[model samples]
Target chain A: MLFSRPMIPIDILVYGIGLAGVAAQAAAGVLEAGRKPFDLFGVVIVALAAALGGGSLRDLLLDRTVFWIADQSYLITALTAGLVTFALVRFVRLPGKLFLLPDAVGLALFTVSGTQAALALGAPWLVASLMGVVTGVFGGIVRDVLCNEVPLVFSGELYATASWAGALLLIAMKASGATPGTSALAAGVLVLVIRLGAMRFGWRLPVFSARL
Target chain B: MLFSRPMIPIDILVYGIGLAGVAAQAAAGVLEAGRKPFDLFGVVIVALAAALGGGSLRDLLLDRTVFWIADQSYLITALTAGLVTFALVRFVRLPGKLFLLPDAVGLALFTVSGTQAALALGAPWLVASLMGVVTGVFGGIVRDVLCNEVPLVFSGELYATASWAGALLLIAMKASGATPGTSALAAGVLVLVIRLGAMRFGWRLPVFSARL
Candidate 1:
């Protein structure tokens, strides 16, 4: 016990938002895994990929210790969510369409979180905005790919666009000397609203029809 | 010119091998992109992703500036290879099987390079070995997923296994105080031989057949 390391306490507000994001993403991962009807191990793998994949990639790109490695709680949360989802599928009659709600929530939260992290790290506004979009969408892309689906970001309705909008807004707020708390709250709300609206209205980007 | 940063000279042997690896991976990426018949920009994107993705991920996790960002030569090499491959595809009657050779060579080189990088950064041997395998395979995985194919590493003949072997061998050699030159050369050769042999012999890992 003398050599035991203590758990590092994170800020409560950040932890709450991050936990919600993890839970939502992990649930979405479980749904994608079920589309493939992968085995238990594969389900966990996909779930973890969905929950932590983007943040891990972002952290790696930013040259920081991966979040799950630094804090075991995130991994535990993802695993629990995956298992609960798997069990729920066996017992409850859940609609397949239910996954999108949590997926949107996760995307919105991650967009703000990634952008904030980048800004704190001294990234240029443009790069920070791009990173936010990448963090928001990359995990879902990984999940879709692992399930043998073409990544939805390539064709999905206004996915990355929503993240980009929210990120740009965050950058603008920061430049205007807004408090971090106010900027993050407004950005998260903006992303969630845009994303939900896009899904509800069936908004989509026009596909290029020309052959190159 | 007064404000220009000096170009740092890299060890010629490492530079040669790394350049070859980047070119080979970029060419393979170009080939993969052609499967989707992507636009010129998409092809270039995938090629850059395939060439730099793995190393970037490794460098980020190791808390180092990405190699391509720090040294423009690597970027130039990857872009040129991608462009050359794109042009060649229009003129040459390349068999699909031709991709495997360059891919195998790239994997071998990347495995050794990744391990050496991790070791230099003071990572434990086990972590270094895993990093090596990750660097060797991540690019191809990204390429396949973007092209809407199941990654070959998920079911292919001894792909990760070869990289793991090479990485472990490198770690062992390094622990025993072997010269960096000897360790890297031996590890690279080991991976190449194993990968080639596996492909030639149709070696594959057993699929998990049990229902969960």
Candidate 2:
């Protein structure tokens, strides 16, 4: 399905968004792993996991050819972005918060794309929506696990919630007969807004500890 | 391939071994997660991840219908094993070392089965062998990740190495025109012996730290 058509304008736009999201997540992965004393290979592994792990899982579940294997661009983009970030960090001390904006954008784009892909494959609504959330947050979860920390998505501000909300909205819009492109755009905007707002205002889900 | 000849003696043996491996891994998962204060649901999630994650990943990479989804018995076995382990642990104080034997068996069975599956699907030798290692270890990695700990396989003993060695052996045997059943049995035995010996003698790979 990915290479059925040559680069039409709409295809270019969608592909561009996907690449940007991958680059953002790869850079974020490098920054997160930087706190640990990992070597370059370790850092690159984290970057690839953060950038591609979620979508790989989604494709696996859907029984599709893995995207990076199908098209080498995504893989190349992640590697280049990771190496650049790794180099930049050594020379210019980057603030931890510097990635938040791009990270939010990546989350939004991934969510929309994942949900749409699932929908196209005729997955049920709940499954499609969950796939969206998975694509948005699972990469970060993997990055944290490699770094030996709790997944930030499990406890961090409104991250997965934002993705889920936007995913559900996308499904709803599609069901209401909206065009695919328009529905995707609206859902992406919603996710970006919610994520950015959450980061700014400390919005969070209730944390609980159950001793049982 | 799994159900083409239902309940033949050989099929029964293979299927039974698969179920036992899943049950063993699920029980191990519950015991590991017991150290954390996760609720029943959380524990169950970890158990399922530990029991099924490896095979699921291998199937996805090989583009096969997921084994559990293709056959519900594996799912039922995993759930039953997890719940039983959870209950048993609450009443009986089990030693951490108690699970090593069954875990070793699981690693052996999963590694052989995964390699065979990949080879059956026409995967190259390297990919098939790696699939075996992935099927042997990825579940434990997922379980540890969910529990917010570094994956034990990464540093503990010769866990992955044993699996990889046996996987390569399996590939070699198959290439030498050994019967699938005999090759699988030999490979499984090799993995079990290596893993148990590693545990008994405390064999280890060199750990390294690089500052760059």
RMSD of 1: 7.3
Worst 10 residues of 1 chain B by lDDT: B203-212
Tens-place lDDT per residue, model 2, B1-212, is 32232332447766787788899899889887777665554566578889999999998778777666455577778989988888777667767676678788889989998998898889999999999999999999999988888788899799999999999999999899999888998999999999999998999999988898
- Score every model by TM-score: 0.61, 0.61
lDDT of 1 by residue, B1-212 (tens): 42244554657876787788889889889988897869989999899889988888777766667778887888999999999999999999777777678678889988988898778766657667867977987787777777877665666577888898999999999889999889988999999999999999987654423222
Score each candidate by Cα lDDT: 0.80, 0.84
Provide DockQ values for all models, in the order shown. 0.10, 0.12
- Please identify model 1 stretches exceeding 4 Å from their true place: A1-48, A57-64, A68-141, A150-212, B1-11, B210-212
Chain A (alone) TM-scores for all candidate structures: 0.90, 0.93
